[model samples]
Target: MAQRLPSAAVLVLHGGRETGAVPPPPGPLNLPGVRMLPFVRAVRRAAGAPDGDVLVRRVRYAHRGWNGGRADPLHDAVTALDALREEAGDVPVVLLGHSMGARAALRAAGHPLVRGVVGLAPWCPPGDPVTQLAGRDVVLLHGNRDRTTSPQATQSLTARARRAGARTCMVTVRGGDHAMIRRAPAWHRLTAGLVAGLLGTRSLPGPVDEALRLPPTAEATLGTLDLDRLGARPHGGPAPAGRR
Candidate 1:
C-alpha cells in the first residue's frame, strides 16, 4: 500500500461542557468546535511546515461534551487519531485543544501517534489522571482570572505531571480571560510557538524551553513562565538540528 505523505500532523480540538448532550440533527450548532477556527489558522500560518509537510486538521466530535465517565470527547479524539494514522502513515502528531477539548486531548495523549499536547485554558480538575501523559510533552496556558476554569487546578495538575515523568510547563496568562478574548494575540502566538516547537518546525521560545528543561523540582513545578519574556516570535524561520 502506498503511504500518505504528510511528515507531521496537528489536530486542533475545540472546547465543550463537562456534561451535555449533542442535539440531534444539529438543532444547536457545535459551537465548541467552531470556537477553534482562529487557532487552526494561526497554527497553519505559524507552523511553517516545510513544503506543507505538516497537515493540520480539526477533529470533529460526535458529541459536544465530555459526558462524565463516558468521556465522549476522548473517544472521538482517539477515533480521529486512528483515522489519522491510517491516512498519514507514521508521522508524529501534536494535540492542541481548548478547555473541555483540552481535557479530552490530555486524556487521549497516550495514543501511540501523539508526541505531545498543548492545552489552552484547560479543565484539568483534581484527579483527572496523570498516568496517560507519562513521557509526553505537556504544555498548559491558563488565564489567571479565569472564573470558568480554575488556573490553580491546571497548575496543580502540571506539578503532578512533572512528577509523573512528563516534560511539563505551564504559563500564567495575566489579565487574560477564559475565552482568550483579552490578550488574544499573546495566547495565539504562544500556542503557535509551542506547537511549532513540538512539531520540530521551529525552536521553542527561550523561557518555555528553559522551563521544560528544568528538573522536576519543587520550584519548577510551582513556578510559572512569563509569556512576554518567552520572546514569542511571530514568524520563526526553521528549527536547527536536534530540536524537539
Candidate 2:
C-alpha cells in the first residue's frame, strides 16, 4: 500500500538546557523534553489532519543543548525538515517549539517548507538571527513571570522578526510561568490554533492576523487568535479561534 501524507506538518520541539550533553537516542526523560509531551498530545488531537494522518512529529536532537554556535537542536531540526519533505512531499510546515526548541525553530525557519513558527516561552537571546524569518508567520507565547526564560526576550525577538519582514507577534500569558503549568490548557489551545492556522487548515488567528495586517514593527494587541471564551485568556478575553 502507498503511504499517506497529510496536507501539512507541524514539527514539535521541546526545551533544553544552555549547556551541552551528547544526547542519547531521543526518548522520554529529563524535565525539559518531558514537559512538552502534553502540548504534543494537544497538537495531535487538534491538528486537523484527516483520517488519522501524521500531522505532527517531535524533533529529535543530536544534543540536549544549544551547544553554543554548534546549535545541535537547530541542526537536528533542519535535518527533520529535510526528511519531512521525503515523507510528506512538499507540504507546508509549521514549527511548534518551546524554549531552546523555539530558539532552534526560529534559527531553522529559513527552510523552504517552513511557513510559520509558534514559539512557547522562546529563549531568543540578544544577537540571535532574525534575517531567516522573512516572509514567514511567527507567533510567540511567553509567560509574564517566567524566570527560566525571559518573556522580554520573546517580545524583543517578535519586534526584530517584524522588522525583518516576518509577520510576527508575541502574546503574553498573564499569569503563566516558565513551565506553562499555569493556564496550561489555554497555552495548548492557542499553540494548536496557531499551528493549524499557519498550515492553512483554518484561517489565521485574530491577533496574528491583525499583526500581519500591520506594517513591520507596528505594535498592536491582536484579539483574533485569542478569540475564544477560555477564562485564562489575557484579560479574560474570548476563547481561541481556529478550532478543528
Most accurate candidate by lDDT: 1
Candidate lDDT values, in order: 0.82, 0.78
**Residue lDDT tens for model 1, 1-244:** 9654998999988888777777313423666666677788888877865457799988877876688899998998999999999888778999999998899899999999999999999999797898888888989999988999988898888888887778888988888788998998888888888898888888777667667766766564444776656653733667768765
Candidate 1 clashing pairs, residues 3+ apart or interchain? none
Error of 1 at 160 (Å): 0.6
Runs of candidate 2 with Cα error greater than 4 angstroms are: 24-26, 220-244
Give the alpha carbon lDDT tens digit for every residue of 1-244 in model 2.
Answer: 9766687888988888897777844455567778888788777766654455547888888787888878889999999999999877888889989999999999999999999899998998989999999999888888888999887778777877887888887777788888899989888777766676676655555556666666774653442133243333222122345532
Off by over 4 Å in 1: 1-4, 23-28, 49-51, 220-223, 232-235
Best by TM-score: 1
